[model samples]
Structure formats: C-alpha cells, structure tokens
Target: MAFLIRKDFPLRGFATCGDCGSNLRSSWSKGKTKYYPYYLCQSKGCDSYGKSIPRDKIEGAFADVVKTLEPSPNTWCGLKPCSDVHGMRDWLKPKILRV
Candidate 1:
C-alpha cells in the first residue's frame, strides 16, 4: 500500500513562477515544536527554482494584490449570481449584503 502526502496552500495553484512560468508549490517545514509554511517553484533549471519563500512574505504579497482589486460599481453591476449554488454562496455576496 502506498500513501501520498498532500499540502494544500492558499496560493498553490494561483501563483506562477516568474522565471520558468511553472505553478508554485507549497510545503511545511517541521521545527522543534511547530511547522513553518513555504512556497517554491518546482521547475527544473530555473534560478531560485527550488528556493523556499517564507509563508508570511508570500501571503503578505498576495494580500496586497487582493487589496488592489476592489471592483467598481460598474464592474459589480455586470456580475450575476451563480446559478449552481444557493443564496449567499456566490463571490458577490459580501458586496450584495452591504447594500
């Protein structure tokens, strides 16, 4: 029997490598009493390819990207509620609820 370990990080599939254009992967390093998260690019032959990026740094940068994405009212008006999910299950819920 074989088992696989999977690490699910927030930016796992969302971020791409700046050098080789590969998707970034994330993992945790075990410390004396705790675990630390890090993101890395797995592409071969790229500089800084396998180097780990500290979780706080990567996550902070992602947060900054999110901060700059406030949609204008016109942009909001073009979106419709998702038909696949029930009430309050769409991405626009928070903005809708505020009004």
Candidate 2:
C-alpha cells in the first residue's frame, strides 16, 4: 500500500529585504546530484543583487534564536497588548466619507 502526504507553507509570501523593502523568493538549483535551495531578493533598481543565503545556514541561525527564547511571568507581562484610545478623538479621525 502507498500513502499520500501533504505539507503546509506559512512563509509563502511574507519575508522581505530590510534595505529595499522588497519581497524575497526561494529557488532550487537544477541538474545537480544533490539539492541546493536558496533565497534571493526580487526587486528592480534595488541594491540587493539577488544574493543567495544557504538554507542550512539560515536554519542553523534560526535554531539558535529559538533556543534562546525563554518564557517567564515577567516576559509574558512585558508582552501585554496596548489598550490606549487617545488617538480616537473627533479631530484625529480621518475626514473622508464614502457612500
């Protein structure tokens, strides 16, 4: 018997360049004995010249960051959502109307 498998991709279209504010894309090299995937910036007139960052290096760095993440009561309190409404005054609201 055979089984079919599926995967979910949450990072399909969100990563971007910090310099040009452009979307980053991924590609795989062809005609190779082994697979190699990389990410590149995809923007016109941008200084980022589609440089490739190795998948292994990126994953290792991300693993380090994840390992450093720790949760505590103080950390949770520091992340509380803001509840201020000072900017909702009549004068501060947008002056446009639509039908």
TM-score per model over all chains: 0.66, 0.51
Q: Which stretches of candidate 1 lie over 4 Å from their true place?
A: 1-8, 82-99
| Whole-model lDDT values for every prediction | 0.63, 0.48
Q: What is the lDDT of residue 32 in candidate 2?
A: 56
lDDT score of residue 5 within candidate 2: 19
Clash-forming residue pairs, model 1: none
lDDT score of residue 60 within candidate 2: 56
Q: Backbone collision count in every prediction?
A: 0, 0
Model 2, span 1-99: residue lDDT tens: 111211221222333465675545666665458767665677777777577656555445545655776778786676534343232222212321100
1-99, model 1: which lDDT tens digit per residue?
A: 111324446555555666776666788899899998988888789896889888788667767766777778898687666564333233422332110
